[model samples]
Target: MSVSSSLTGRTLIVMPAFNEEEAVGNVVREVKKTLPGTVVLVVDDGSRDATSAVAREAGALVATLPFNLGVGGAMRVGFRYALENGFDNVVQVDSDGQHDPAGVPALLEALDSADLVMGARFAGEGDYRVRGPRQWAMKVFATILSRTSRTRLTDTTSGFRASGPRAVALFAEHYPAEYLGDTIEALVIASRSGLVIRQIPVAMRPRAGGVPSHNPFKAAAYLGRASMALVFAFIRPKSIYRTGSNA
Candidate 1:
């Protein structure tokens, strides 16, 4: 897909940080390097470390949350900020530096035709292998999401994505609040609300610093909660978030 320069300055890159002090600065710098003039906002999810300071020093805006809200909650805050601040687009990137900044252009370019564009690691040209219980859980969740939403998505739990105004508004109001929630549940919400969702292939790197957010040990618990969220998403009535509703 050809990338357009229209959303360059208007887009807001939302990076949710949780004790990612070591990686936040570099991540912010990398995003700015990839997408010049784009606004990078780091949502400090009640980090005990210097994540906020580091992000701010790295030439990005920072919104420090009062307490830890996990990835979903932090992303909701970023969405709200984007909505209130008059951004035309929003991209979700992990602060741990696992998500490739170079993919932001593809996601933004895909956003021209899609309300939401997911940077899928597994669906891409190269192989991004997942092993153990986490892999099993991801496959199961992907199957459930694809079957229910009727959209074939290879990476259901991927955090790398870009959202147009329609999706940003919807998610800002009622995003998922569960532990392993945001990415999958938000897609379901977007699909139910009549927004177009698409996925593009993107490469992912290992976390630069801090521990991986989800591991095999937590896979069982994540699967349970995520299953419940998926079920509720399907059962819940569709409510489209209209443009300018929040204005």
Candidate 2:
């Protein structure tokens, strides 16, 4: 995918981080290298480390939240920033360095026909093989979401995604503020709001540092909470999410 020719609209890459000092800098640098001239914004979720400073030094625009807003909140801030700054396209890349920067163009290329494009590690060949109960939960949610949205989705919990202007505006207004906010809830919002969702296979690297976001217990609870959120999304009026976009 040739991002240079495909991205005629202004683009912003949003990286939400929490205590990702060890990884954020290199992630920022890699993103800049992959998509030169595209704005990279790091939303520091009140990290107690040098994450913000390192990200700034790496040449990214930084926004430090006064407190931890979780990934969803941090990303909401990013969407708002994108909208306010006239960015027509937005991409969410995890700051933990798990997402490969080279796969960015695939998402952007998919965006040519999709309102939102997700980089699905499980959709095709990938290095990050999810296992155990979490893997089971992902499959269950993927099935449920695909059936509900009438679109096949292999990775319902994947955070790697690109959004168009309409998605950027609606999500900036009412993004889910809970666990799996960046993944399940955001996808539900986009589907219900009339956005076309597509998936492209992308490989991912392991986290650079820190523990995984969820343990076994939390993963189960996440499935339960996500189920409830899905119910709410289905009942919500679709007209409420409609936004004007030239694209």
Candidate 3:
């Protein structure tokens, strides 16, 4: 796809941060450096630290939640922000710095043909590795989601993704807020809603700071929860989040 300069100019970059003060400031700056004048909003997900201040210090618009609400919750606020602010695209980037801002333009360019475009970590560009039960769960989830979306997806749980106009409008109303729902179950919602989904190769980076959300010991439990999230997503009624127009 040919990338248009206007595509990135009008896009909204939503970085969901939870106690990521250590890296968010520099991440925000990096985004500004890479994207150059694109609007970057940092949704401070109820961190006890000065995440909001740090983000603002780095020249990003900040929205603070009263309490922690995970990535899904923070992203919902972002979608609504984009909807209200005239942005036709919403890109979710992690503020902990696992996602490179430089990959964002490719995601937006993909919107020319897809309503949702994911920056895939396992699509032959990144050396990012996952193992054990978590890896098992990811492969299973990817296989199922690939079939459901009718498009192959190598990284079903990647946090780096962009939503086009259709996805932005739909997700603003229906985006999930549950554990593991943001990426995995969220794609299920988009698929069931008849949105086009696709992905492109992108490099993943080491976390700039903050604790990892999961670890090896939690792998078994993660597999179970991940399966449940996918199941619950498929079973949800369309009317729960759709109007006739969006449906």
C-alpha lDDT values of all predictions: 0.83, 0.83, 0.90
Q: Mark the 10 consecutive residues where model 1 has the least summed lDDT.
A: 238-247
lDDT of 2 at 5: 37
TM-score of every candidate: 0.91, 0.91, 0.95
Query: How well does model 3 score by local distance difference test?
Result: 0.90
Look at candidate 2 and tell me the lDDT of residue 38: 83
Query: What is candidate 3's lDDT per residue for 121-156, written digit by digit as tens?
Result: 899996998898888888998999999999999889
Evaluated at residue 27, the lDDT of candidate 1 is 92
Lowest summed lDDT window (length 10), candidate 3: 238-247
lDDT string, candidate 2, 71-141, tens digits:
98999899999999999889999998998878888888788788888888887667678676678778988
Q: Quick one: how many clashes does candidate 2 have?
A: 0
Candidate 2 or 3, higher lDDT?
3
Task: Tell me the TM-score of model 2.
Answer: 0.91
User: Candidate 3, which segments miss by more than 4 Å at Cα?
Assistant: 1-5, 244-247
Model 1: per-residue lDDT, tens digit, 1-247?
3344567778889999989999999999998888778899999999999999999999999999999998899998998999999998999999998888878888888877889888888985556797866677789877876765677888888889999988888888877767666877787888777788888899888889987777768766766777777777677656434444532
